[model samples]
Target: MKQMQIYAFDMNCVSHINHGMWTHPRDTSLQYTDLDYWVDFARTAERGKLDGIFLADVVGVYDVYKGSAAPVIETGAQIPVNDPLMPISAMAYATRHLGFGVTANTTYEAPYLLARRMSTLDHLTKGRIGWNIVTGYLDSAARAMGFEKLPEHDARYDAAEEYLEILYKLWEGSWDDDAVLADRARAIFADASKVRAVRHNGTYYKMEGIHLAQPSPQRTPLLFQAGSSARGQDFAARHAECVFIATPNPQAARPIVGALRCKAEAFGRGANALRVLGLITIVVGRSEKEARDKLEDYRRHASVEASLAHYSASTGVDFSKYSLDEPIEQRSTNANQSALAAITKEASKPVTLRGIIDQMVLGSRMRPIVGSAEQVADRLAEWVSDAGVDGFNLARTVAPESLRDFVDLVVPVLQERRLFKADYAEGPLRQKLFGGRGRLPSSHPAAAFRT
Candidate 1:
C-alpha cells in the first residue's frame, strides 16, 4: 500500500476556506498575526507527521458578492489578511520536518524579485519550502495594483509561463553547482567565472541579472500548483511537482485526477509526474455520535452568507443576485475557472443558491467527513483507492483544536493502518514528498535550464 501524504490547509487570517468558522468561540485563527501562533501550529503539525502546512492567500476582498466589501468585512471572511511569507522563518525555526507551502501570486510581482525572495526563504528554511503558484483571481487585486481589471484568464497563464522560464534561468542556470569557493588562503570567496548573469527578453518581461542569493540546498523550491482550469492543468503538467485540487467528493475527484495525470503524460511527463492532493475537511471524535454532535455544534455557528461571499470572489459570480431556487449558470470570469468548475461541472448536481447554503458546513462547501478515528481512517483509505489521489489538504472546522484532534486521534489510527508515516523522510521537502531527490526531476521544465 502506498503511504498517503497529508497537508493542513490554512491562511494568515481570521477566516480562510472555512469562512465563518473564525466566529466560533474557540477558534484562535485571529491570532494569525502573532508569531507564537504559527510556531505552535508548526510544532503540532510536525508532531502529527503531516507533510506540509499549505497557507492560502488572497490580495483582495470578497466584494463581488454584493457589489461592496461590506458583507466580507462584516462577517470577517478572509479580510484583514496578512502576508503568508512573513511567518515562515519563525515556523521553520520551531519544526524540523514540516514543510511550509506559502502562496505567492506571480501575476503582480516581478520575476527577478520574487526569485530572490523564494531563494532567501529556501536558505532560511533549509529547503523545507514549496511555492503555491497562483495568478491573482480578484479584480480588486488588479485595481489595487493600478490596473482597471485583471489580465484575461488564459493571458495570465501565458505571462506565468514566461515568468517561470525566467525564474528557472536565474535559479538553475545562472549559479553553477560550485560557484562559492570560500578559499581562505587564496582569499577568494567565490569563483566569478562560475556565476553568470541571466538575460531574458521575453514578451512579458525583460531582465538581465544574476540571482542575488547563492544557491540554496534545493536550487528551486518544491513547486506546488493549484490551477484546475484546462490551461491551468497544462501549466501544472509542465511545471508543478504537486497539484492541489478542489473537488466536492470522491466521486467527483476520480475523473479530475485521471484527467490531470493524462494531461501530464501527454506533455511527455510520466502519468505519475504530478502528485494530486484533493481538498477535504474532517470532523472526528471518540465516538461516531460524538463526532456528529461536534459537527452540529460547528454547523450552528457557520454563516451561510459568508460562505456565499467567499464563493462569489473565487468564481466571480455573486450568488446574491439570484433567487434561492435559481439555478446557477457558470460563465467565464477573470477569477479561478477551476473553482467554478468544482461546483458545476465536477459536482453530481446543479449548484443553486439554496443548494449552496446547504453545502456550507463549518463555513465552506467541501462536505466534511464525520466519524470516529477508525472510521475516518477507513474513509481516507477508500478515498485514496477510489479517487486516485495521493493525499488531502484538510480544511479546519475550528482552529488548532480541529488540527489538534486530527493529530492526536486520527494520525495514530492512520499510522497503525500503515497509511501514514511514523517518522519523516530525511532531506529537503521535494525529496521527502516525491523521493530522496532535492531538486526537480529531468522531466520537469525547470531542469532544462540546469547548467
Candidate 2:
C-alpha cells in the first residue's frame, strides 16, 4: 500500500474544531498567543513525519444561538481567535518539510490584497504555503464587515468563482517564468515587455493592473476546498486540488466521494487530481485499556454548552429554542450547507439535541480510534481502502497530547507496516506532495494563466 499522508489539523485559537476542550488540564491551547507554542507544535509534527499542519479559521463570532455571542464568549468557543497567517512564518522557520494550509475567507477580503499576502508567505516559506478557500458563513461576520446581510448560500459560491479567477490572473498570468532577470551587472531586475497587466470586470470583482509582486516559488499556492454542497462541490471540481471532507462513516462517504470524483472528471480533470482527506480523531495508547481510559478522562472536560454554541452557529439553528429530545428539523439555511447536510443526510437517523450533545462529549463527531498501536494502524488501513480516501486530517482532541500519543504510539506501527514515511522529503510543499518542483500541474486552470 502507498504511504498515507497525515495533516495535523489545528487552528490559531483556544478553541478550534473541538470546542471547550481548552478547560482540559492537559491541553495547552490557551498558549496560542505565544509564538513558541506554534513553532514547537510544528517541530513536533515534523519529527513525527506528518505531511503538514492545516490551520482552520473563521472571521466572525459564533453568535447565531439566541442571536447573541455571550454563550460562545463565555465558553471561548472559537472566540478571541488570533490571525492564522501571522505566526505561520515563525512555524515555517522551525520545520523543514511541514506544509502549512491556512484558511482565509474570500467573501470579506479583496482579491488583490489576499493574492499579495499569500504570495509574500509563499516567498518567505520557500513554497510551503497552501490556501484553504472559504466563503464567510456567518451573518455577524458580514455585518461586522459593513454588509447589510450575508449573501445567499449559492450566491456566495458564485462570487467565489469570480474571486478565484481574479486571483489566478494576478498570481499566474502577470509575470513570466523568465521575467525576473537578476543580473547585477546588467542592473535589470525584470523585463517590462514580458510582464503584462490583467484586466477583468466581473460580477463580484474588478481589477485593472499587473500583479503587485514578483512570482514566488509556486506561482499559485496549492488550492484546498471544503465544500460538500451541490454548488460547493461544483466550485471544488473546478478549482480545488485537494478537497476536505468530514463524514461520520466510510459507508456514508463513499457516495459523496464518488460523486465528487465523477464531477471532477466530467469537468475535464483526472479522477486522481482531487485528493480527498477525511477528518479523524484518534486516541491511541500502548494498550486498548489505556486508550479507553484516556478517552474517558478527556470526555469529562468536554463542555456541552460550548458544543451547542458551535453547532448553532454552523447550522444557523438555535438549539436553545428546541428541547433536548426535540428532533432537529431539516431545513435550508444561509450558514454552512455542508454542515447541515452532514447532520441530515449522512447520519444514521434524524439527529436530536440530546444526540448532538452525546456526540459532543468528546468535542466532535469524528470517530475516535481507541486501541494499541497495531490495532489503530489496522483500522486506519481499513478506512483508507474502504473509503477510497487519500489520507486523514487528524483533529486534535487535546493540544499537543493528542498528537504526542499518535506520534509515540501509532506512528511506529504505521512505519513498521510500511504505511507511513519515516523521514522528510527534499523540496517545497508541492514537490513533496506531488513529487515535482514548483507550481501546479499543467492541466490545472491556474497554469493556463501563467505567462
Candidate 3:
C-alpha cells in the first residue's frame, strides 16, 4: 500500500486555477491581500496533514480573451495577483509541519536573484521550501519583461537548463556544509577557505560571484516542475524531485507517470527518482447527498466565459475566434502545449468550445471528486493504485471552506485507512517527503555540484 500525499493549490489572487469561483458568496479569496486570511489558511492546511501549500503565480495578466483583458479583469481570472513568495515566511511562522512550494518562472527573472530569494525563504522557513519551476506561458508576460514576443517554447526550456546549472553551482558548490562556524572566541563568522565564487559564462547567463547567502537547512530547495511535454519532461527528469501532472482521469495519468520514471532511470537517477503528483479537486461532505448538493451549489457560481478566458491565455489561443461548436485544431504554441494536448489528442476525443465549456463545472476543466469522506478516500486510493501517482495537488474551489471541509471531513477517513499521514514526520520538507535525508540524494544532478 503506497502512502498518498496532498498539497493545497492556490495563488495570491482572487481567482487561481479555478476560473470564476471567486463569485461564490462564501469564498474568502477577496481577502488575498490580507495577512490574517493567509495565516489562517496555512494553519488549516497544516492541521489537515497536507504535505504543503503550492502557490501558483503568473507575471502578466490574462489578456488573450477577445484580445482584451476585460473579461479576465471583470471576473478576476488571475489579475490583481501578488508575489507568491511574499506570504511564505508569515505562513511558515504560523505552522510547523506544512511546506511551501512556490511557482516562479525561469524566463523572466535573473537566476541569481531567484536563487537568493528561494534561499532566504528556506532560511526563514527552516528548510520547508520547494520551487515550482516554470517557463512563462503568456505573451503578456513577455511584453511586461520588454520582449516583443515570448521566447520559443523549446528555447525557453534550453535557457532553463543553463539556469539550473548556475543555481546548482551557487547553492551546492559555493559553500561548504561546515563553512558556518559562528564561533565568537576566535571572532570567526564563517570559514573563508570553504567558500568560493561560481563562474559561469553560459549561452543564456553569465555570473561570477560567491552565493549571496550561506546554505540553509536544505542547500537547494526541493525542485518541482509541471511540464508534460516531451522537452519539458526531459528537463523534469534531470532536475525535478517532484512533478505535477494535470489530467482528466487516472487512465490519462498512468503513461505520463511511467514515462517520467523511465526517463529518470535513463538519466541514471534511478526508477523512483521522480514523484508524480496528479492534479485533483475534491468537494467532500458528511454524506453523499450533501456532497452532490454542494457540487451543484459551486456549479451555480461557475463562469464558462471566465474559464474560456483563462484557457485562451494558457494555450495562447483566443476562444473568441472560435464558434461554440467549432472543433479546436492542434497548433504550435509557445504557451502551455500540454494544456492543449489535454483536450485534443491526449483526451479520449476531440474537444470543441462547447466541450470546453461543459467541462467547467467547478469554474475550470479539472474533474472534481464529489462524495462522502469514505468515497473520496476510496477514489484517492484507486488513483494511487491505478494512476501510479504518489500524491495529489488539490485545486481550491472555495477558499477556507473548501480546505476546512477536507481537513474536518476527509482527512480522518484517509488516516483511518492508513493511506495518509496522521502525524507529520519531523524534519525539513525534503526529508519528510523523500525520507529522513535532509539534502538532495547523491543521484540528483544538483549533487554533482556539491563540494
Best by lDDT: 3
lDDT of 3 by residue, 416-448 (tens): 989999899999999998885689999898989
Candidate 3 similarity to native, TM-score: 0.98
The lDDT for every candidate, in the order shown, is 0.89, 0.87, 0.91
Give the TM-score of each candidate.
0.98, 0.97, 0.98
Error of 3 at 58 (Å): 0.6
Can you write out model 2's per-residue Cα lDDT over 1-451, one digit (the tens) per residue? 8788899999888987777678889889999999999998998898899988999999889987878999889988788889999999999999877899999999998999999999999999999999999997999999999999999998999999889999999999998888999879999989999899999998988888988889999878988899988998888988998888888778767777898899888888888878888888888888899988988888888777888888889899888998988878878789988788777765568888888777775776555777888898998898788888888899898998989888888888899998999887888888888877757888777777776
lDDT of 2 at 425: 84
Candidate 1 vs candidate 2, lDDT winner: 1
Instruction: Estimate the overall C-alpha local distance difference test score of candidate 1.
Output: 0.89
Off by over 4 Å in 3: none
- Model 1 weakest 10-residue run by lDDT: 342-351
Listed per candidate, the RMSD to the true structure in angstroms reads 1.2, 1.3, 1.0
Q: What is the lDDT of residue 69 in candidate 1?
A: 95
lDDT ranking, high to low? 3, 1, 2
Ten residues in a row with the worst lDDT in model 3? 341-350
